[model samples]
Target: MDTLMPADDLTDELRAISAVVATLEHAQQNELPDEFAGLFRHDAIWTTGGGRRLLGRDAISAFTHQVLPGAMAASTATYEVEHVVFIRPDVVAVKVRQTPVGRDGVPLPGVNPGSPTYVMAKEDGRWLLVAAQNTEVVDG
Candidate 1:
C-alpha cells in the first residue's frame, strides 16, 4: 500500500492528471490520432475497451488511426475523471468514466459506460500516461 501526498500537493497532482485525461478525450472526440498518442510515454502500453493491447506510442497511434475515424460515425464520447490515487510522488493512477452520446448530446441507450484506468508518471515535470486499460461496463 502506498501513502498519499499532502492535500494541496494531491490536488495539484489530480489537476495535472485531469488535464492529461482531458487531452485524451479531446483527441478522441476530434479523431486526432497523433494528438491522442502524444499524451503517452514513448513506451506506454494501452489496452483498448475491446481488449486489444497496444505497446508503445507508435503502436497506439497505428491502432487509433485505424479505428477512430469510424468509431464515432454514429456517436461521440465524453470522458470524465472519476478518481485519482497517487501511488508515489511521481506516479498516479486515474480512473475515468466514459459515456457515449449521440449527436444531440444525449447518451445512447443500451450502451454501458466505460471504465478506464490510466497510470501516469511524471517525467521532466510533465505527466505522461505510462499504462492504460479500458473496460466496458456490463450488466449481468
Candidate 2:
C-alpha cells in the first residue's frame, strides 16, 4: 500500500479546481446553461440536489437548458470550494458549499444549503468535471 503524498503543485491545482467551482457559481447565477454544461466531461454523471440523475454531457446540458432559464428570478446561489483531495496526479475530489442568496448577497429565507462533491480530471492541461453529486442539507 502506498500513501497519498501532496504534490508540489498542490496549491496551483487547488486554484485551478476552485476556478471551476467559481465558474459554476457564475454560470448558475447568470442562467448560462451552455457555460455550465461546458464544465463537465462528455461522459460525466451528475446527481442534482433534487435527486435527479443526469447521464452524459448531452443529457446534463439538456436538463440544464430546460430548467435553468429564469430559475434565478428570485434567488441565485454561491458556490465555495471547501476541500480538494488529489486522488492522483491528474484526478481530484472537490467538496463545495452552496448557499442560496438574494441579489444583495444575503442568504435567502427558507432555503437550505447544498453540499456538492465534484470529481474532476486533468485533461489536456484543463480540469474537467468527471462526476458530481449535489445534496441539499435539510434541517432536522
Question: Which candidate gets the maximum TM-score versus the true structure?
Answer: 2
Candidate 2 to truth, TM: 0.93
The clash count for each model shown is: 0, 0
Q: Model 2 clash pairs?
A: none
Tens digits of per-residue lDDT for model 1, 6-117:
7777778778889998899889888888899899999999999989999999999899899988677678888999887778889888889999888667988998989999
Cα lDDT computed for each candidate against the true fold: 0.88, 0.91
Please provide TM-scores, in order, for all candidate models, with all chains considered together.
0.92, 0.93
Candidate 1 weakest lDDT stretch, 10 residues:
1-10
* Model 2 CA deviation exceeding 4 Å by range: 1-8
Error of 2 at 40 (Å): 0.4
